[model samples]
Target chain A: MAGNREFANRRLHSLLGVIPLGIFVIQHLVVNHYATNGVESFNKAANFMGGLPFRIFLETFIIFLPLAYHAIYGIYIAFTAKNNVGRYSYFRNWMFMLQRLTGIITLIFVAWHLWETRIAAARGSDVNFDMMSNILDNPFMVAFYIIGIVSTTFHFANGLWSFAVTWGLTISPRAQRITTYVTMVIFVALSYVGISAILAFV
Target chain B: MAENKNVRFIITRQDNPDSAPYQVEFVLPYRPNMNVISALMEIRRNPVQANGDKTAPITWDMNCLEEVCGACSMVINGKPRQACTALVDQLEQPIRLEPMRTFPVIRDLQVDRSRMFDSLKKVKAWIPIDGTYDLGPGPRMPERKRQWAYELSKCMTCGVCLEACPNVNSSSDYIGPQPLSQVRLFNAHPTGAMNAPERLNAIMGDGGIASCGMSQNCVQSCPKGIPLTTSIAALNRDTTIQSFRNFFGSDR
Candidate 1:
């Protein structure tokens, strides 16, 4: 029973990563890709998502709950766990440490980005191409967004690979290796979409 | 007053498994050629604190007195090791002792290492033998194979590796380095190879090799210097093959 607690907790942590978080990441990237069309088109797409029925309830339940659990539990793990990458420095060891670090950076970035965009839009502020372009006009802001997006992309990609392993979807090394390649491709594609959207604003 | 040379100890103590742990200081008369175990024994004999108050005797597990038993593993000045082998001369003053929390603490410095034994059972870390009839000697391992297998065989079920592993925490079910390395050892044997598939399949689960975060701490923490991470990597490959065997209904 004690063992099951640990197992269940770990499974829950891994499950939360891919379900709403990974799904939301893909959806977000796709929505942002509308920027490539034009300012009007991007605004219309954004407005459509914003104008969806039960937006508050859906966002609260689907996005916020999982995000809160993952971030808070992740922070607890980061505190309790030890990192020996300084001595061992194995590839997987480094990745393990990097996952925690990126999670932290992503948490902060997500909070700030959501506040600057979503909350503003909710509070009746103009959330169009002009607003995004103006925000990205600052070299510092552009750099910050780039770093945030890259970290988010890495987190989602690596997260998917771990999710498959955690859920027993990829049990063998060959399967895991194939999953890694696939996730790497997803990472590249997602990065392209994210950077392209940023560039569209510029 | 005569000059008295003594060793100071800061030991974490708990009355029972449910009680909160606390630290108490003891200053034992420094004896030449003494180890941490000897110091602990001295403190047990006296059961007095450095502040001149009588306290309950500190409790810890030990056997064989040498490093072989691995029953005396504890955190010595923040590093986990066999307390029996921690020489006083080599250690700094005010040595700190705490139970390895990787397992459930049973008392002051004693922890229940049943988790490791349970994992060994889970992996079936043994070679099955035919009974009743006098079977001929088992197949001989090549000298090269025997050499490394001997190292893996030296594991005394010490919980140090688990203590050092970030993945095998209070909330994690990671069946840590010791049992995984033993899998490699047993699987390499001729008769043991018959059960290799079962062992490999055992480690392919939640608490198995998948839970390893690859900290490499196990390799460093192992007193016998066993290549734990190496074994885990090897087991990863073996389990991959085992999974394929399961998939295709072939044992190749």
Candidate 2:
């Protein structure tokens, strides 16, 4: 029935956010964090990830397919979401609004990022430390990356709170509050890593 | 807590269903241990505004002067609750009363709550049985399950949860939390279990359980403390299983 399909689609959207996509965001940031060690180390980490077995298969299946679905469906959810932060200015209410806003921003950021990195790599440009450094060379790109990183991390973190509720992980208020704190820590920690990596590239 | 001899009320009044709402202030003689309902009654007794102007008697719906009926629900001091239980002493003066705007306001402090009733009908929140024929006794539920089901059954179809939810506004068709909790309540019944799939299917659609943003205002606003979010979460699991069953063609 139509109802079952809708539930399954929404649940798939929620599940894909955490699985593979959320994990990929964290893992991608950690790889970028290797920039703090030096240019050579950053390139080594990037190369190691890029040189994995069945690399194209993994990227197509684990990364691109899920990211495509999450981004496309996420845009639909974002535009359709009726944000009522003005009338109902509660904590979770704001989170509900921000999740949609950040989802859109993160989508744009990810698209531009892939254009600079993966798409360029497909055109034979090496995805080395210098490539990222050149990308962050300008002040505007640096600001853009900083904003993009923060928004992406926030989308993931606040998304974890929603994911917990949607999957029945945190049903009680106390449990939800605890998840809030935990996700806050995640947002802060991931933002730090992501920003530091960008600065290191600079 | 002020030492003023009179309690001031700023009531949002609408003359009719399509009329614009306006606020009218009323100053009433302070009565000890009076609730919002009593204060409204006092205003209705003498239709005089604080400005000494004559006005129509304030219109509202009420039956039981207790919190059970949920008929006297309104936004008192910007919070949705039963006016019967909102003690004047506990609420800060001047008390502000407004209709629950999630539904269409009929008059002063009264909203048409047919949305909730329609949802209850949609979900089939009652067990099906006919009194004309004698049926055998139903299966027994464990004492623990019955205790919790009793809590869920406490819902009075009040629109407080809908009022508190940002998603349940006129723009959205979300059934809100009240009837969703009733789904859990009725589905737990031995005889009602026969229609469990129907109830679960009801909530799995658009404007159904998927529309819940988990803002959690419902649980906080529910006067009955009915663990609404828990019910929704349980339904999340239930609907998940139901979707699988539908996929595998085993909805038996």
Candidate 3:
């Protein structure tokens, strides 16, 4: 009954995070990394993705729907979570607090990002190099994007660690410790790509 | 270890459930290889404070002086563990004692662990049998599976895992890790498998398995080294399949 639905919803939240949403973050970062080459290179990559067939359907189903559910449910999970970091202060305990925090930050950042880019494009603005450059022209926007990018990457990377445990991939302490290291590497690598791309716009 | 030397203790004490808690310090003559329970007994014998004031004897809970009973669990020097096994030689001076906050403090160190017991009841952590007639012997589990189940069976309903967990608290009804691990234990039993769906369904609800944030402090905090996180993870898979079956209208 209701219990089964709650379990399924939670599993869906975990799954959607790593599947389409997590993959989308990586893909988005890679596409944005193209800006490191030059304005034209970045535009070409962004346009190619934008011009895919069934683009609306893909955005609605693969991207928007899943993102919507993950974000909404994630916010609930974040607020309801009773963080005992102050008392425990264990490695995983701090990560648990950070996961909730980054979830909230990433949600706000993604909302503003969508308003500036995709929503603007739908309203007859071009999503191009100049558009990104104009957005980063302000120092505050630059700092905001940096924070946003780092937060999003940390959320995704740390999330992968929990995802492995949630799916029963890492059972032993040794296995969990190994994934902690692996996910730390992921956070560092993805943050580099994201921060470098944002700086490139500046 | 001189006989004249003494060990100082700062213990948190509450007169009753309705009263506020306060701290009192006691000085006991040093004894070699003394555990927390034995030191408390010394304090109870004289009922004297560090300042030489005659006071009411400190109250706490204990049954088996061994760690197996789990009744002596309290926060010693900020870590939740069995006071029975907490040797005085190993603990820092001025050893601090506090009741496990995850449960409501009935007096001082004695918490109403009925939360954990209630959870065990909720999950039906037992094999139900008809007493009308004598049933035949139960089916035997493979030796390998039996060994694994034995590891999980070591839980003594101690509140250490819950105390270590950030999720379980007075405000939250997450049921912590103890009962969830018990569900895995009972569900694995051959006779207990009859109610697997019921137990799985119990944990599927709110304040159930989904409440586990995977902070994983439970596994590390378990006194018996029960693989709590592993059991929760296995349940994640089991509940996932159970959800699918429920959705597809499959009886199996």
Candidate 4:
């Protein structure tokens, strides 16, 4: 019974990565593209999402609950696991460490970002183009967003590849090789979309 | 020149399984072609530390002085490998020797490798050719398949891969790389394929292949170069197919 739970946890961990989280990332990138149009357009897009029927229930179930599980469980994995990249500096080994490192950075970045933007907006703060552009006016903050967004996207992309392998979705070497390229494309594409949104603010 | 030269060893020692570990240095007269085992033998004979205090003879396990036995596996110079093949000439001075912590330490450098053996049993890593009499000729395996399978059969239950793997620790139940590779070997055999589903099911459970963090350390640390990660990737696919078969209630 205990063994089954362990197996099931790993299975669920991989499943959740692709489901609400991965889907959320895609939806997020698309929604953020509205930033390129100006604050009013972005607000309209954001308002539609915010004004969903049973918005609290959907956010609680799909966004908050799943994200919390993924983030907390990710931290647990990060803490318990050890890295040997020093002795064995293989590409995959480095990727393994980077994934965990990025997970941590993403956790912090996402928390601060949500609080500064979404939560603040919810509290009746005006999150307009000037506010965002002013926030990115500092060179250091720009650099911070670059690192934060890049790592988060990389974490999600590389994570998807590993998740497939872990769950036995991609088995053959050829299949894994193809999946690597696919995930790399996802990383680059999503990163472009994400970074462009930040750059637009600048 | 021999008298002037001394091979230095920093060995991690523990009096009993429950004892705390401490390091003791020994300076033995240098000998040409000395491996970690030979230096250890000298330490056993002298039973004295560099500080000249007499202590219990160091304890470790070894059978074949060659690397094939995998009995002399330990962490030498911060890397897990077979001590028999680790030559003194290639190593830096004051070489470090420590027990592999992936398993319980039975004594000084000796560790109980029963965890690995138990995993082998759990995965059913053997051809079940029971019963008496001469069973007629078994099905033949293709030469190409046999060739790769031969490479995996080289595992000696050394526990080096286990030691290198971060997931296979006291707190985690990960089965490590050795037995997972063995699953590939046994499943490849012509006769062994009969129980492939059973072995696949074993690995699909907890501490199975899912626990692998993909550190890629085991392949580099393996004395036999058994392609541990490759086996893992292959098993990932096999188990997926197995899972589908299970859902549909068909072994095919």
Task: Quote the positional error of residue B126 for candidate 2 in Å.
Answer: 0.9
Clashing pairs in 4: none
Question: On residues B91-170, what C-alpha lDDT tens digit does candidate 2 reach at each position?
Answer: 99999999988889898888898888989898888898877889878889989999999999899887888888867765
Across residues A1-202, which tens digit of lDDT does each residue of candidate 3 receive? 6545666777889999999998999999999999999999999998999899999999998899999999999987887777877767877888999999999999999999999999999999998999999999999999999999999999999999998877777776788889999999999999999999999999
lDDT string for model 1 (B69-170, tens) is: 889999998888999999999998889999997788999999999988999999899898978998779888889988988989999997998887878886
Worst 10 residues of 2 chain A by lDDT: A79-88
Model 3 gets an lDDT of 0.89
Docking quality of model 1: it rates as incorrect
Error of 4 at B55 (Å): 2.5
**On residues A1-202, what C-alpha lDDT tens digit does candidate 4 reach at each position?**
3444555566667778788888888898888888998888987887788778998887788778888888988887787676777766767778889989999999998898888777988799776667668779999989888888899899999999898778667755577779889998999999999999988888
- How well does candidate 1 score on lDDT at residue A185? 92
Candidate closest to the true structure, highest lDDT: 3
| Superposed Cα deviation of residue B62, candidate 2 (Å) | 1.2
Worst 10 residues of 1 chain B by lDDT: B236-245
Error of 4 at B182 (Å): 0.8
**Regarding DockQ, does 1 or 2 come out ahead?**
2
lDDT values, one for every candidate: 0.82, 0.88, 0.89, 0.85
Report the TM-score of candidate 2, chain A only: 0.98
The order by descending lDDT is 3, 2, 4, 1
